[model samples]
Target: MLLKRIQPMAYHARRLYVELMFQVMGRALQAVSEVDETVRREARALPAGLLFEMMVMPDGPRLVVEHTGDGHFLYHGSQAPRAVDLSIQFKHIAHAFLVLSFREKTAVAFANDRMLVDGEISQAVRMTRVLNRLESFILPKLVAQRAVKEYPKELRLPEKLLSAARIYLRIVTHLFQTARTS
Candidate 1:
């Protein structure tokens, strides 16, 4: 009986963790693409209105984002009406959290089969690059190094800090807009 109770509580906590990560990651993706020309080019190469999602299993939070035209994307709620072009579905809440956890590499997660891709392979690769770029901006050197195969050494410290600040500010503004609209 105690085990059953603890299991549910743990699940809820992990679920909440995954959901919050998705929210921030979603906004950061959009914000980075807006600010980085290379990322913007990558985003533009994708189909216009193409929606991407990272989700946990049944009833868990889903982060949905759409590639609006002109190299920009907007985060769409999980309930958004548009069709999802590609989705990276985590096996479970803990699995999602583990892969997204600080200092955890997504490539390792993929190799470990923690995530499943439900769309085109090319798009997934492109999305991976976008996520890697965003992570480089937001995560610390130690943590970001583990997340991607390479952390660009060319990126100056000041530039990275500035980009992170801008990305965070944009994320907060986006969250405010999201909350107000919701």
Candidate 2:
């Protein structure tokens, strides 16, 4: 009698977990679908020969979006994304690249620490370009959210370092141009 009672409780708990998961999934799906629509809209405006494949691994599912040929788009949502030239993994919803009110991709929790990138170097560069575009679009929102939080001064040093490097490059470029023209 005790074992039977325990079994029912365990089963109910599992069912509850599934239901909660679906609820979260519904929200995420909505977000991703919106992003898909935006991609489609943007595809219409892009110039030719800009072949793009976006593989996004969100927290719960992986989304592969490929824009093939003149404004054609294909997409799917699954735990196991189709093999492609590039894949981007997000560890959490916060890490996901939100596109047009939905996420383009999400990752499992541990993948962020693992930092796995499966693709050729050229593909990596392409991935960077794609991400750079997305970052420019959505990064301000993320920064604004974080701006309200109390971050240690030490944590921001890396950004300062990068800014300094950019300034140094600009100065060097000016010097080189002067040297060459003179």
Candidate of highest TM-score? 1
TM-score of every candidate: 0.91, 0.32
lDDT of 2 by residue, 1-182 (tens): 89999977865664444334333332232232234333334444443333333323333434444444344333332322444555544333333323212333222222335234565545444434333323333334455233222222332445534433443454355446657988
Where is model 1 more than 4 Å wrong at Cα? 1-4, 180-182
lDDT of each: 0.84, 0.39
| Candidate that would win on lDDT | 1
Residue-level lDDT for 146 in candidate 1 = 82
Model 1 TM-score relative to the real fold: 0.91
Worst-scoring 10-residue span by lDDT in model 2: 100-109
RMSD per candidate (Å) reads: 1.7, 17.5
Which residue pairs overlap in candidate 1's backbone?
none
TM-score result, candidate 2: 0.32
